[model samples]
Target: MRSPASLVLLALPFTLAVPAPAAGNLGSATTQNGLTAGGCKAMTVIFARGTTEQGNVGSLSGPPWFAAMSKAVGAQNLAVQGVDYPADIPGFLAGGDKKGSAKMAQLVMQAMTACPDTAVVMGGYSQGAQLVHNAAAMLPADMAAKVSSAVLFGDPMNGKPVAGVPAGKTKVICHQGDLICAGTSTILMPHLTYSQNAGEAAQFAATAAGM
Candidate 1:
């Protein structure tokens, strides 16, 4: 059997396509390396893609959010890094991928340590949102508090706090019909439409991150 990413290639029912690199900010590359490239910027966005999604940042959410954030914070001032993980359904069923969540947390601290002046934002979609919650719990309060903000779309853990992150600094955008936001595994139309909320989430992140 093939993975969901591959399955998406065979079927178009899910509409997994994201917004084409969010207006060329990412070009055609599906992966990102701003955090580990020995480069620092005004802000760092560590985003995790949804389960069964393509690349590290799924086209359905992360890219759109990145586009909005780029406009809000200025592309030159922003850096994006997508979390690497299996993004398989099994991981989502397991309450997010363990290794992925750990990596996200590490990236957060790494961003802070590497760029003391740069703002750090944790973000994700679908199971990726679950990873955001898990990653927040893995960090110490002091370190977590240092994180500038968090933005989650089509969240599986909606209405739940993002551990040590201040409620005011975190944004969770869930559509009313999105079953995943309601804490269920069922994927609904609302969940697939999170890209529409990208601007709103990005604006909130910009304010929270002091952009």
Candidate 2:
């Protein structure tokens, strides 16, 4: 049970040189998502974003996107968490770096702390998906056990498969016509592309229901 303040301190050392906005806006996305001083149990969902042109999480694409998806899944009873802090391609490529990974891990932990006792479901679009995938690997064993599922959209983790992700609970969804799906040279992976008709949405809905 690391306090939020202490976790921030632990995360500072690994933070990169990228310019962070004023403290007031650091968790602005969280605030806009309607997360206050309480927690919920239905499901705690974390939404990470892809590379942003602004390099900040307070963009229109991040929060609004999560809200839309939240409604689509009928997650009203679920506690939704948004991690909109933006990271560029360079930042993503540097994702495996110690600090970057720690920061991501810290965010996940904070989300868990905010909704202790709830099932956790981590989801992201494109590059955001990649970060969530990596963060899943960094989650503490006990916390990892609490993760009900992880949904990755648009982008894959390239070559590195996360080891701690609960088997049968992790899923990948990509756009069939999207060029990103073709570049994957591997098989036997649980991959569902948009070309699979409406099945992709159904799979996601099913996973959410289970959570």
Candidate 1 lDDT for residue 122: 95
Q: Write the per-residue lDDT of candidate 2 for residues 3-54, one digit (tens) a residue.
A: 3342233323323322444322322242333244345646565656544323
Q: Please report, in order, the local distance difference test score of every candidate based on alpha carbons.
A: 0.83, 0.50
Which candidate has the highest TM-score of all?
Answer: 1
Clashing pairs in 1: 18-59
TM-score of each: 0.89, 0.60
lDDT of 1 by residue, 1-211 (tens): 3244532443245745443343234534456777887489999999998887777787888777888888888989888998999987778878899999999999999999889999999999988999999999999989999989999998888889999999999888989988778776667577888878888988998998767
Q: How many steric clashes between backbone atoms does each model show?
A: 1, 3
Local distance difference test, candidate 2: 0.50
Which residue pairs collide in model 2, if any? 14-99, 57-84, 176-194
Model 1 worst lDDT run, 10 consecutive residues: 2-11
